[model samples]
Target chain A: AQTIHQWPVAEIKAVGSPLSLGCTIKGKSSPNLYWYWQATGGTLQQLFYSITVGQVESVVQLNLSASRPKDDQFILSTEKLLLSHSGFYLCAWSPTGVEQYFGPGTRLTVL
Target chain B: QQQVRQSPQSLTVWEGETAILNCSYEDSTFNYFPWYQQFPGEGPALLISIRSVSDKKEDGRFTIFFNKREKKLSLHITDSQPGDSATYFCAASAGGTNTGKLTFGDGTVLTVKP
Candidate 1:
């Protein structure tokens, strides 16, 4: 079975602070990776997706960027945090042309 | 504009009853529909899904009814239990793109009383 892990389960940061969240998938090789964000009582928004290592596509511009430095690892980062950036960030992986499997997710609060 | 929409922002039902959730989308290119269940502080999990080619899909107590002409789909939870209480999200995707990226609705919170 495959398992996905996300780091820093939760975080509280002040505005203008830098932030970085990581996700790693085990037992799956060459899988597609995606990043999604959901605000409190809001719909889930797709941020970025990557089909292969070192290449990522932006689905929506939230002033955040994603990198897939390794086959099993995906990283979401930002240089400055805004109040609107506070939300639950989810990392997902999927085989080509199938539904995605989401990670535990990271809760971020920007003050 | 929001491409996907779900009705009854919240729902409550007694155990053993049936719970129905409605969803609709605007994009004709969306050929795949999925319903996800999420507990507090957890990621949404795929509960059931239906392709545009099919009108319905079922998994045990969960069933999805799709109306391709209306661009609408619904999830039916039969014999609802307390464990079924959670926020359910309706999502749509364009399978032809093969991106595996889904567009999600605002979600419906279901509460099943024992």
Candidate 2:
């Protein structure tokens, strides 16, 4: 079975603060990883996706970046938080295109 | 282009009644359509999915109907229950991409009443 884990389930940060959200997947190697943001009552917006280590692609530029430091780890980071960046962040991995498995999302509130 | 669009921002259904959610897409390249169910704080789960080559797919109480030419799809939940209340999202994707990125719909909130 495959399992995905995310850290700091919830966080509150002030504007201009740095932020980092981490995710790790087990039981899968070199799986496709993605970072998505969901605003209040909004759809899931894909921010970034990575297929291999040390390679990442940005789909939407919300002033955030992502890095694939390891085969099973992907991170989303920002040097300065924007008030509009506040939302529920979700990390997902897919072994195949048929379905995607997601971790418990990280709820961030930027004041 | 907002590849996908879901109807009825919210829905209310009586217990044991059927709840239907509609989704349509503008992109013809989309080969996969999936319906995801999400609780208030959790990530969306794959409730059911249908491929472009097939007209329908079913899993237990959940059924997905697909119209390839119309580029429309719907999710029908039989015998709704209070536990089934959640936000349902419609997602579309192409298969050839290695990134496995999905285009998602805004979502519809379903409330099952007893």
Candidate 3:
């Protein structure tokens, strides 16, 4: 079975502060990765997706960026945090880019 | 514009009753549809899915009815249980270069009472 792990289950930061969240998938090699954000009681919005290492595509310009540093790891980061950036961030992996499996998620609170 | 849409932002049903959730999309190229179940804090889980080529798909108590011409689909949950309460999201995706990127609906919150 494959397991996806996300770091810093939760975080609280002030505006203008930098933030970084990480995700790692075990048991899957070179799987496609994606990042998504969901506001409180709101729908999900796809932020970025990476099909291979060092190549990431932005689905929506939320002013955030992502990197696939390794085959099993994907990172989401920002130099400055916006009030609107505070939300539940999810990391997902797809074996065939059709049916995706999501991780536990990271809760970010921008103060 | 939102490519995918779901009706009845919220729903309530009694145990043993059937609960239906509807979804529709505007893009004709979208060939895949998947429904996800999410709790308050956890990530969404892929509950079931259907392809445009098929009119219907079923898995145990869950069924998906697809209409390719109308660009519509629906998820039906039979014998609803209280445990089924959660936010259900309808998602659509197309093949080719944009494959696997899903556009999700706002979602429907379902409550099943015993």
Candidate 4:
């Protein structure tokens, strides 16, 4: 069985602060990784996706970037945070294009 | 523009009643559709999915009805239970793209009364 883990279950930061979130997948090698953001009462938006290590594609620009430094690791970070950056961030992995399994997710609050 | 849309921002039903949730997409290239269920503070979980090749897909009490011509799909939950209450999101993806990025709807909150 495959399991996904996300770090820093929750975070509260002030505007202009830097932020970083991490995700890891166990029991699956070379799985596709994705980052998603959802605002309160809003739709889930795809932010970035990675097919292989050291390469990531931006689906939407929100001043955030992602990198897959390892086969089982994905990191999402920002140099500067804005009030609008607060939301629920999700990490998902899929072996194929058919279905995706999401991690526990991280709740972010920007003040 | 939103590529995917879901109707009835919220729904309420009594236990054992049938609950219907409607979803539509604008991209004809979208061949795979999946419905996700999310509780108050958890990540969305895949509930059921249907491919354009089929008109309907069922898993136990959950069923997905797909209308390719109308570009519409719906999720039907039978014998609803209070534990079924949650926010349901409809998502679509163009398969074989490698990216597998999904476009999601605003979601419909379902409240099943016991």
Candidate 5:
């Protein structure tokens, strides 16, 4: 069985502060990883996706970035947070097609 | 392009009743359609999926009906229960030769009463 893990379940930061959300996938290798953001009571939006190590694609320009430092590790970060950045951030991993496994997610609140 | 769209932004139904949720897509390339259920404070989970080649797929009380020609699909939940209350998102992906990148709909919040 494969499992995905995310950290800090919840975080509250002030505007202009930096943000970092981590994700780790167990039991899968070279899986496609994705970052999604959902505003309060809104639909999920694709932020970034990575197919392999050292390569990440930005689907939306929300002042956020992602990196696949390792095959099973994905990180979402921002140098300075904006008030609009507050939302639920989800990390997902897909082996190939259709089905995907998602982590618990990090709830960020930029005050 | 907001490839996928779901109807009834929110719905309320009584227990033991049936709840019908609708979805439509604009991308003709989409061959795989999946419905995801998300509970409060939790990540969305794959509920059921149907391939474009198939007209219907069923799992327990949940059923998915696909119409490739009309570019429409729907999820029907029979005997709705309070536990079945969650937001449902419809997603589509071009299955073959594609990376399984899903384009999701806005979602419909279903609330079931007792």
Candidate 6:
């Protein structure tokens, strides 16, 4: 079985503050990891994806960065948060990069 | 641009009734379609999916009817129940050849009355 875990299930931060969200995958080796953002009740937007360690690709410009430091971990971070960065952050993993399994998710609120 | 679109921003159905959710894509390059079901405060789950090569895909009570020519698809939930109430998102991707970057629709909220 595969398990995806995200840290700090929810966060409330002020604008311009730095933010970091982490995701870890267990029981699956070398799985593709992806980060997505969604507004409250809105469609999901793909932010970034990592096919291998030390290699990350950005799909859309969301003022955020992602890193795959280890085969089992993917991290999303931002130097400075904007008001528009508030929303739900989701981490997903896929073996074939087509059928994906999503994590529980992290809710972010920027004031 | 919103490449993927869903119809009937909201829908309501009774128990044992059938609920139909519609979706369409504007991009011709999109060849993969997947439907996701999301509950409040949770990540969306892959409900069912259909490739452009196939017109229909069924899994138990959930079925996907696709029309490649029309660039449209519909999700039919038969024997609907209150537990089936949630937001369904229609998503599209280019193909399996590239990284899976899915374009999502706004989503349709389905309410099932017991």
TM-score of chain A taken by itself, candidate 1: 0.97
Q: lDDT of each prediction vs. the true structure? A: 0.93, 0.92, 0.93, 0.95, 0.91, 0.94
**What is the TM-score of each predicted model, taking all chains together?**
0.98, 0.98, 0.98, 0.99, 0.96, 0.98
> What value does DockQ give for candidate 4?
0.85
Q: Over the stretch B19-91, how does candidate 4's per-residue lDDT look in tens digits?
A: 9999999999999999999998899999999999999999999999999999999999999999999999999
Every model: iRMSD:
1.3, 1.3, 1.5, 0.8, 1.7, 1.1
Clashes of 2: 0
Better of 5 and 6 by TM-score: 6
User: What does candidate 5's lDDT look like per residue over A24-100, in tens digits?
Assistant: 99998889899999887888888888888998989899999899999999999999999999999999888884566
| Ten-residue region with minimum lDDT total, candidate 3 chain A | A40-49
> Model 4 — TM-score against the truth?
0.99
Model 2 residue pairs with clashes: none
Q: Which stretches of candidate 1 lie over 4 Å from their true place?
A: none
Which residue pairs show collisions in model 3?
A97-B100
lDDT of 6 by residue, B3-104 (tens): 998999999999999999999999998988989999999999999999999999999999999998998999999999999999999999987654778889
Model 6 interface DockQ: 0.75
* Candidate 3 lDDT by residue in tens digits, B53-114: 89999999999999888889999999999999999999988955533688999999999999
lDDT tens per residue, model 1, B34-90: 899999999989899999999999999999999999999999999999999999999
Q: Select the stronger candidate by lDDT from 2 and 4.
A: 4
* Residue-level lDDT tens digits of model 1 in A15-99: 9999999999999999999999999777789899999999899999998999999999999999999999999999999977568
lDDT per residue (tens digit) for residues B90-113 in model 5 = 988888742557889999999999
Ranking by lDDT: 4, 6, 3, 1, 2, 5
Instruction: Provide the DockQ value for model 2.
Output: 0.76
Please report the candidate that would top lDDT against the real structure: 4
Q: How well is candidate 5 docked (DockQ)?
A: 0.60
Better of 1 and 3 by DockQ: 1
lDDT per residue for candidate 6 within A24-106, as digits (tens), equals 99999999999999999899999999999999999999899999999999999999999999999999998888888889999
Q: Which run of 10 residues does model 1 chain B get worst, by summed lDDT?
A: B94-103
Candidate 2 wrongly placed segments (more than 4 Å): none
Error of 2 at B94 (Å): 1.5
